[model samples]
Target: MVTRREWLLASGAVAAALALPARSAFAQPARTVKVAIGQKTIAPNLVNLLIGEGLGYNAAEGFKAQFMTVGGVSNAQVAIDRGDSDISTGVPSFALPILAKGEWGKAIHFYQYTYPYKWDVAVKPESTLTSYEELKGKNIGVPDFAETAFPVTKNVLRSLGLDPDRDVKWTAVGTGVAAGVALQRGAVDALAYYDTGFGQIEGAGIPFKMLPLPKNVPMVGGQFLMALRERIAKDRDLMVGYGRSVAKASVFLAASPRAGARAFLKMYPEAAPRGSSEEDAIKSVLLATARRIKLYDPPYAGAKIGSINPEEFRIEAQMNDMKISSFDAFLTNELIDEINSFDREEIKRQALAYA
Candidate 1:
């Protein structure tokens, strides 16, 4: 026989015991993966990564991604080479030369972001440069002579019957805003870079005219996720996990890009400078996301989000004049196939539910 107080105390103890296990069950710690990005600022591509993290996609794959910004792809590669980062984003055309020369450890490209040869040659709005033909003998600013932009731009010029070496002058201007400054100051007659570079220039309120690359030229490769071959062999599970997480994020972005913008701003509030409206920042991000989404359609026909088209790689290698015994030396499809193995319908449903 127990008093009323004694009965209440027993009930409270039972409740505590039941709740403790539930809390512990939900509290699993996540593993951390360091990602080194080429650009210092938060672009739409970075926003997709951030949204994936915010939505626990990375954690679901047993990873907690930490993104570090080095100045350029070269810098990001240096960081990875030094073992300061686990993975880095870069262009295969740029990395291949280094790999061919044995300057860096062999790497595996696990993901593809943009289609090759998507760069545009742009000029000031008031300028008379209307065709690639006119660019001959004109100063064209590229991010780097050794990077993808230079070779792609050269191919475009060659296609137009212009001698890249003798007819056009190439200048290595810094990326995005810096390149825009070169154009604004009349330092370069034209600027050739990725869509993001042109986006940055337009976003800064400087109107510009762009000449699109010809569709006939073989597609050069685009940006990709790379890790040392040794790391991939040792940590295959982690690489597969990253692919799975990013695949889901890609579907989510395609379904709802606005949600991506909101997530980006929430994760990095500093992206919006002082006196700028949240709405404006969100719009900017959405625009960037839209551009990225376009890169996934049509030319890149596939179900897997990060699928690397072998033909694209072959074409890129040919364009860059590099010899590769096998494409497998640089890329692997195992992880991407695993990522696509997830229920496609369910992924689409999740993306649609973002709104």
Candidate 2:
């Protein structure tokens, strides 16, 4: 098994750390948390974080979220593992592999950031590839080889009766415009990535024929809010505060997706399209965020927002071949009640009044 230190050194954790230059957010901050995201782009996947910032949710919680993106989910997890960041958002599959390899004490996922399997495989316009089976021997362009899509693609191919190592070629096409360009120029035959990434790709004016997820793999869990176990143990208030803000942000977004998009643009004004009018830009963001918003719906995420569903993790580990000794070993719902301690109607009221 590769030790955590060895993996960090080999994975260029130092470089990843540098990419996320130190910055601060709140002035009288009780806690300054370094939050790592998968990609740098201002896509819908990150709108909740933006909402948290624009709406002052984090500030109200007494902690400041200093955000950074290292391009992929695995790298984001690595940021937490290397102590480059105190918390990160990632999938259970990404963290399980690390735990299966004995990389303990790195981090523990406590809150469900996203509530469903949001990844998908897509072929560019004019391609006849209707099924994932057609992906055999085809080039798959992903954001990163260590990303959630990488392992998910591998498992998907396996379930489709294809040998992933021998049947497919994978390339790191980054995200958004880079991914769109790669597919446009035929650098890869198919694009395997997550929800908001595809949203950005579509915004590039390149249509896509999305392939359905393989039916055999029972992957259910999605992105999560992860922090060190020690951090949660010693500083419970910080974890509860941060996650509570995120949960409220989720509620605010669900209450009004358009408002969420508006909040996103408000936080990152440059994210607004270059020549487009304000309403048009906000509409584009709404379109990009539509699918992701569905994942956080009441029916899918269930009544307890941000709570851990053990069955989901069990299925995730089983399908991905991670030897998880126990579901509780990697996650906890103990903080769920605390994280969700927010008034839904108040968030709805705020969303309605959002500029």
For TM-score, the strongest prediction is 2
List the lowest-lDDT window of 10 residues for candidate 2. 17-26
Residue range 115-190, candidate 1, lDDT tens digits: 5556888888899877888887899999876456787778667666778889988899986667888988899999
Top candidate when judged by lDDT against the true structure: 2
User: In model 1, which runs have C-alpha deviations exceeding 4 angstroms?
Assistant: 1-28, 102-104, 144-148, 159-161, 297-303
Using all chains and alpha carbons, the TM-scores for the candidates as numbered come to 0.82, 0.88
What is candidate 2's lDDT per residue for 94-148, written digit by digit as tens?
A: 5666677766654878888777677888887788888889888899999877667
User: In candidate 2, which residue pairs clash?
Assistant: none
